[model samples]
Target: MSCVKLLNDFPFTFSREATYQVCEKVETRCSFLDKLGIHLAGIWICECSCGSSDLPLDHLRSDKGWSLPNRLCPCRGPLSILKKQLCSWSEYYEWRGISLDSPVALLLHWPLTMYQAIQLAFGKQLTNETTDELCIHYLGPERELYQTAVFGELHALLPGVRVHIDFVGPEVPHDRDGETISLSSYAHCMEANCSCKTPISTDDSSKITLRFHSGYYHDCYEELTKEFLPDLIIAPNAGIAAYKSWLPTIELIREIEVPTIFSDYCEEACHLAANCITSVTGTPLAIPVQLNPFRHPLAVEDSALLLPCYSNCFLFGI
Candidate 1:
């Protein structure tokens, strides 16, 4: 492939039907590996939670990259190409030494190592120090087991005054922590940030919401090294904000592990709002998305491959 072929394309397209058609025609030793996952086709790399466009594909999927792909991104996350092969952006093991086995811890970075940060989790030895490590350093951890802490805690005190979590866009600078949001901004797009995008009812879970999504939009090239592959990664708060139009709450939390679910349910809503795209740099909110480089580089192009779980480099919904 030529560098020119991998530069930039606004609306990146894939031959999903054609790819699938061809997939159906052939059979490999690992039929599952060769049977392209339906969601992997025709993705826009830019929608990735990270702040990078494709690394010329040469850097990411080159012959050399394929030889020692683990060196590509130390954080054990997913790859855009893998999504096409495996149903989830994760499942890196299928590709051999190309993905982060420790997806959740991979998202966190040093100064507060991902491993150390995760040590202070809900089920583990969660203490004021541990909670402080996560709350102060990462804002919120992105492990699926901690969904209650990340998504729950919504307690509406009165009518029209419900609790809710949201992504107010990237407005601040990088903090090496979790995504930061502007409550006022979320209030303005109230409907856009709902759990199911529906208003709170008496028993609505979101009535008591938690807003720990996208923060700053940047990449992990600076931190990740061949010598020291990150065991964890930060979130991709900014990039997700860049695609705010096509984003929502559930996708915010579960996009990586459950891309089809997010795409099937939230993609339409987010795509519809694309017309009013807002520049994240100009906003008053920002959060750092720690991800495992084991995942793909931060997605900045229009085509992106959401991970099966933390393996996807991103800040939850960002």
Candidate 2:
């Protein structure tokens, strides 16, 4: 059975078509170990509310990601029925046989969410062009630094286009500051026969390159812009109303007049951000707050509200 048909056996909040589209980009097994300078064994540890279990790498298959397993997790909370039907980052990646040493859904979320935001702001026709280059300034990155290699999926999603991302945030580690990394090939799966298992030929010039800037955007804005100007700016899980630190950044963004997009965990957060953006920029949002189709599939634990909350659940542009 097809992955989409199998996925429909369970009750998921997201559309099957959307999930299938995202899985295509995220299903690869490439660890980018050469890029991150890390080594690993054949066992991947699975963690959840139930606990951790060691899973052998060889046992994982592409079919496991879409179909709900007999036992999702050991947790038996009130919401376990729906939760058990949901899969983790590890399971989702299994569709394409991706088995990174420590895979997190956010690893896929960052790139996919950004891709969707770009489509929302600029339309899909622009990304489909083979000759056009897309430059993005990503703000407030925290845990994503550990798995930058996973972002190589962009090349597949935006085929033949070069994507340049400048990640600016205070959470950037001191040691990696001002570092630049380029991914010239698709993140390959471990399977020996996988189509993308080999390095991309040099003839394919498209690539995804990332740069790290260690500081608040307001402080680094003037300096960063000196080198590369971006076509778009993305801020994921931006708590605009909750933080005063965003004030200067918002001011600067308004002045630059760049097409900026932001995602938050909930509608209320996006609504508040919209108000904040208008307050700072003196204009309404270009893209009103709406649900992001590329949101993380699993429910977030210990959420403040009773409503379902996932990473980058809502998005808006200014």
Model 2 regions lying over 4 Å from their true place: 1-106, 128-131, 192-197, 202-204
- Candidate 2 residue 227 Cα shift, in angstroms, is 2.0
lDDT of 2 at 315: 88
Assess every candidate by TM-score: 0.20, 0.68
User: Per-residue alpha-carbon lDDT of model 2 for 113-211, expressed as tens digits?
Assistant: 876787777754344333467789999986455446557656655656778889999877666788887765544334445444445554334667789
Best candidate (score: TM-score): 2
RMSD of each: 19.8, 12.2
Give the alpha-carbon lDDT of every model: 0.24, 0.60
The CA-based lDDT of model 1 is what?
0.24
Supply candidate 2's per-residue lDDT for 44: 18
